[model samples]
Target: MSFNFYKWLQEQDDIIKKGVLFICDSLFVDCNFKGYYIEDNNLIGNVLAPQYETLKQYKELNPYTNTEHIRYFFELTKAGIKHVATVLSYERSKDTMQVCLEEQYEYITIENGVVEMTNFEPLTVLIKEKFKL
Candidate 1:
C-alpha cells in the first residue's frame, strides 16, 4: 500500500499526532517528511528535511515534557535525527551518557544557548549536517 502523511497522520491517535508535532517543532518548524516505513512492530525511516534553528528555539521547544505513554512517537522522531533527539532531551546533569555540561556545550543544553554547535560533536558528517553545524 502507498503512504501519505495526511492519511497516516489521520490513522494515529490525537496524542501521537501531537507528539509528532511537538518533536518536529523542536527540530524545526519546517520539517519535510517524505515517507514512513516499518521495522519490527515500530514505524521507521521517514525521509525528512529539518531546517536548522537556534538553541533558544530548541530550549523553548523542549521542556521536561513528561511523555510516558507517548514516548514512542518521540522515539520515532529521535530515530529520524539518528538519536540527536536523545542528547537534546537529556535534562538531567547526571545522566551517564551525558558526556558534558550544558555550560560546556553551547546549544547542547538550554543555558549556553546558541545556534552554533561547540559541543557534542557527532562522528559522522551526516549527523553533523543533520544538526546543521
Candidate 2:
C-alpha cells in the first residue's frame, strides 16, 4: 500500500493514547504512584523508538526537506501532535509543527523535490489545520 502519513500518525496516536490509558488504569488499580510514569518510558522505547528510527531513515535517504518522504513524515508528525492534544484534552496548536516545517525547509535543496520554497509556509499552515493542530 502507498504510504499514508496521516493515517500512520493517527494509528500511532491511538496506540499511544490507549497505552497511556492502560498505564493509568494499572497505576490506579495498584495504587502505585511511582509506576505512573513507568509505562511512558516503556511505550516510548517499544513503540515510538522504532517509528522514530524509521523517520530518521527516511530523512537520511532524502537528506533534504523537499522529498516526498520528508513531507509525508512532516504531515504525519503534525497529525500525531494533534492526536496527542485531543487525547490530552488540550487545544491543538500548530506553532510547533510550523516551526519544525520551517526548519526542515531551510535544509532542503533543489534536488529534494518539486515543492517550492514559498509553498512551504502555506503547506505548514494547511497541515496544522488538517491535523487540527
Clashing pairs in 2: none
TM-score of each: 0.20, 0.20
Q: Which digits, one per residue and each the tens of the lDDT, describe model 1 over residues 1-133?
A: 1123223323432423343344445545333332222111232456242322222332244333332111121222234443322222222221212221112222223233221222333222323344453
Candidate 2 wrong stretches, greater than 4 Å: 1-3, 29-133
lDDT of 2 by residue, 1-133 (tens): 1134323433443333343334334323211111111112212245231233244344344343332221122213321242211111111221122222323222222222222333233333433444444
Model 1 segments more than 4 A misplaced: 1-14, 39-133
lDDT of each: 0.29, 0.28
